[model samples]
Target chain A: MNRRPTLWLLLSFALVLLLAFACQQFTGAEYFIDSSSCNGCGECIRICPNDAIYYNQSGKAEIDQTKCTHCANCVAICPNNAVY
Target chain B: MLACALQAQNAFTLRSDAQMVIAQSHTGVAGLNRMSWEHHFGPDLDLSVSSTLNSNDRIIPTNVQKLWHNGLVDINYRGTDFTVHADYRNTVFGASQLLGLYPTWDPLTSQKRLMQHQGTIAAEFDADFLQLGGFASGKILRYTPYTLDLDTFELVRQDNANATDVYTGAVIKVPIIKGLATHVAMDYKSGTFADNGEYDLNKLNAGLNADYKILGNASVSASFDWTKRTGAAISNGKTNLLRSTLRLRHRFSNSLAGYLLYINNSCLNDRMKNLRLMANYLRAQVQYSFPSDPTGGSYLLVGGKYSPENKADAYFVEGDYKVREKIYAGGSLNLQPDWQALISARLSYYYTPVNELHLQYSHRQYTPWNNSSLDFGANYLGVGTSFHW
Candidate 1:
């Protein structure tokens, strides 16, 4: 079988990746939990697949910035709408 | 015979769900639709392609919309004793706004998006008495970070949330007795963030699981796992976890049945310093069900979950009654801690065996244990429809 088609496909994929990376933008804004609104129901903790959210000293939910992947799953799962 | 052969070789399916939610804070509509196609090369080989679209306006607080689109392709092959499977998925998530409280937040100005690509492959072999399996999976996430200014689009920081994760695992299962089975598994996971090396970590997991059946109605299952984390990450620590569950089910008569379930999860070691995790979550639930009417479309359930860790107790009673051949009415009442309660009623109409429409109303009251001024109540009215073919 000819390998030209496979080579071309790989080349195209690499080009697309390069373009996507070049056009991407970033900022310093981040999501935080409103501690006053948090009910400590543990719903966000259970829904975070990365284990980034945990209980604080006050038993309120807190997000570990290092482990957070910005999936926004906690934002959707929090019944009290604490995550912003 | 030809039609049968064709049908066996190819199959297609479509499913869609649409819901409109009306709440005190916001009103929104959500939709999810999926389409899948499968082709069988032979009895032992097959391929499938699936696409899904999901969108919700109330996913975030106070009126933010999120849309997710995903595509997947999977292939499987089975031989005499071994099977191989592989799949790839690409997903995109877009948000209409970053923050509802922000003054500059707008649908077009402060939008965000994320793209993810994931691939997985697995192989398994069966040896009559035992089974062996292994899998490897990888994912790449690219997030469009939040912006401070919408007009100038000034990029101040690199994307810290962009990450890649790789995981591999192996498992072996053995049958010990007629109704008992045991399995041991090991997994290794590694992850890296694009701009933050402090978030990079490597983890190893080893676990054992066992399931046993006592007689025909009672079963017990348990698992013990040990996890070790290394690297510069903040969660670098070692933890041991044990989980066990016991379920007992019985049928008292032709129309009445009951089940009792108890689950316990505990951490064996307390060495983790940075994370304030839940040490234990113990819950027990007992549920009894009985037919409400002779037409068999209705039943009543009474169940309660009691947690000893935080005094979080919940009790619920639910029932559904068939009002007509195509219509049904159902309601439930749930009581929780701190005087929190939820009461809901639903009416469902079935147009066909695979299609349904439902209207539901729920009222919820939440009061925190410490603060009574933070108490709030909300009412929700939802109408949803599901169609399948």
Candidate 2:
């Protein structure tokens, strides 16, 4: 098997990391849930370390931006990839 | 999870809502109404303020009203690894556990309230491979029954029913290897009861935990803690507690996984050396997830546990099925040999991007302690909606 593709993928990942690092000073990353993709599963609400996320009346989970510590727990745990 | 996300410092967010919950059973109808507000300010120096007002009729045998207040302030300097926070909370909520520590199910009856006023401050220093943090908190609790005086016909305020707790703790964590971390934590706690000063307490606790990832897919974690508590007002009175837990998890396939856990707790009281208490529990759980598709996916979890102290076994099973992405239904069931079984189910529907509706129901069947011939249980059903801006 040709190793070129694997090498290119690694290089691309490194390039993206480098760009992210370079752009860190100008713009920071923020955490938000994409309501369009949210399933209202309430999993994120249960696993939040800060209890910063709650089920809105709509049954969808929303992040309390003030209480959120930017822990990214919900982002990692969301099965639908809804939290950003 | 970028901490350096670009955000304006002056930005603010708010959530304000009103909710009504009604539970119906064979006996009668119960109603609950609540209003809440949450506000946040600033990005660099964040401040959060929240409040809730709750009124309930038939939660217990009577009517109850409560108000809650919570606030938090966090300061994180730009381009630094130091962060600090302070918070205050006053809450009157349903009691889950006895004395806030002892595990009991008696609180399930009535609108038993555990009122707490607490304040805390903490600071942390984050560095590569290592982290250090410390915190101090104080709380006052009013856990006595809320009742009216039979003679005076007025609300009776138990003046000496309060308990005050002060605690200070520190923790350190280190990453030892790839996918492995270890932590050490220590704390000192003091408590005083207004009713009986002789029950005042001073306690010391220390704990260690280890986390390791195995085979890049499996994980193992272990935690151990030791506690020594002494009655400050009484001479030669002490209690020692030891607790340990071990958990192991692994994935069998793309959609199947399982975990095993063992927990042991033992306490020895100097005053009751003959009555040393020890409890051991072991549980095994398995989970399965279905392949995802446009119509949606589903997952199932089942677990069973054995307790030697009670000579009883318990089983739990939970599952969630997503009918496409806009609607989902889930339910959980728990059964124990000695007591009753609990069943709960919930359904959610997403009408739009910012609107949602949810319905839930639960039932628990058991025989009352006093009335052995009769089987008694409770049923509850609730519906709620969420709207966002």
Candidate 3:
């Protein structure tokens, strides 16, 4: 029974769900912080473990879109690389 | 007064890292090494050390040699809110048993040399609505003593395993209304397996969470968890699990934001052999920044998963830029479905203000199941430095 390798694994799982639905219908993914090289030096607000950074009002360092989980550990622990 | 004397000054930091890795597959080329050191003594102690090295260029085990070496250490402490940590690790690896496609080139899994050691201790305490923690860990493994020139299997007697683990957890936060909050937690686990005493293990878990704050940039969270596990070598003889999670976040401005996540899991086992397992997962993401340059940024993620005969989907997009002020650049692209496609790139340079230098690259393609299609590539050149006082 060679159903063509199960029809090529169901056409590669329907082309990975049609390219993940065309990448969520054209883009969207969150994580940001770059107040001009953030000098708010909160060190990503103490490594924000979901306290999702803070210090806006031009103090720079904001990042609390519902408590970031974009896990990048504050963009690799921003050392003035300013979270990205 | 200079921000209160710089918030009661007391800062010190030191960091150092080195990396060199080159990997290529078509059955050849391999070299990897990493080094690290970190220290901080302000805001409560800190220390770290790391090392890893691997090489044994693959290609039909010419005179056997499949390398690995690893070491790690970390220590941390924080007072005035309590926190403590300690960790140690050691590994001397090379244990394979064919898990497929270049499963490090099987042959009954490259002959022995697997020694591992681990140690851990943790503690936590926070009071702003109560929080607590506890942890303990231990591990030891050995598996050297094997010989079989030119590899081709055959060389047994690799047994040595030890274990000891303990955990205790706590959490409590309440504050409903005006940006809501409610969280509860409990956890316990114990493990023992000094030479496999029936693989002893135990676990208990409990959870409840809720966080709300819709409007003013939105926020939502939900959680539920329950777990119970027992030993007897744990293989569907005693297990129970239930998990649920939901999350949603929004912030349509300040350069945009968005997120959504969902998870579900269920498991049951033993009742005279009645095992079951279920799973579900969903993810969504959004992030953007570039509004007149926020040092540039980007994010895009998509996810899906369901089980009971598998179902999966994935997507990815990432970006970063700072090309001004100490050079920085990033990129990422990933996809899934038998895993095919993965591209990565990075560039860094900070050379002052705490040193840095970096370069990275990645390329991957997959389709395993004896369906021919495997491409892998990696390259990393690194240099790092840091010092603050």
TM-score of chain A of each: 0.66, 0.64, 0.28
What is the DockQ (computed on Cα atoms) for candidate 1? Answer: 0.04
lDDT of 1 by residue, B1-389 (tens): 11112334477756566666555567767677877788989899999887888787755332233677768788999999999988877766666344211121123322243666667888999998999998877666655455445567663333535557666678788865444456776655555443445544444455444444445555444444444545454322324333333444565566766665443333333363322222222233333333554544577767665543334456678877778777878898877653467788988887864456788887766545422232245566677665444
- Least lDDT summed over 10 consecutive residues: which range in candidate 3 chain B? B97-106
lDDT of 3 by residue, B1-389 (tens): 11122222343344444445454444444555555566677668877676766554442211123565667677888899988887776666563322111121233432243455556676777776666666555544443333334555555444443323333445455543333344555544333322443434456666555555556687766655556666653446236554556667898887778777655454456453332434345656676765644434323333322221222344567666666677667777665544345666777665653345656665554435412322333444445444444
- Of candidate 2 chain B, the 10-residue stretch with the lowest lDDT total is B1-10
**Which pairs clash in model 3?**
A28-B286, A29-B285, A29-B286, A29-B287, A30-B286, A30-B287
* Residue A9 error, candidate 1, Å: 56
TM-score order of candidates, best first?
1, 2, 3
Q: What is the C-alpha lDDT of each candidate?
A: 0.56, 0.52, 0.49
Q: Clashes in model 2: which pairs?
A: A28-B4, A28-B5, A28-B6, A29-B5, A57-B385, A57-B386, A58-B356, A58-B386
Best by lDDT: 1
**Candidate 1: residue pairs that collide:** none
Candidate 1 chain B lDDT trough over 10 residues, lowest sum: B100-109
Task: Encode model 2's per-residue lDDT on A39-64: one tens digit a residue.
Answer: 75554653443334544322356664
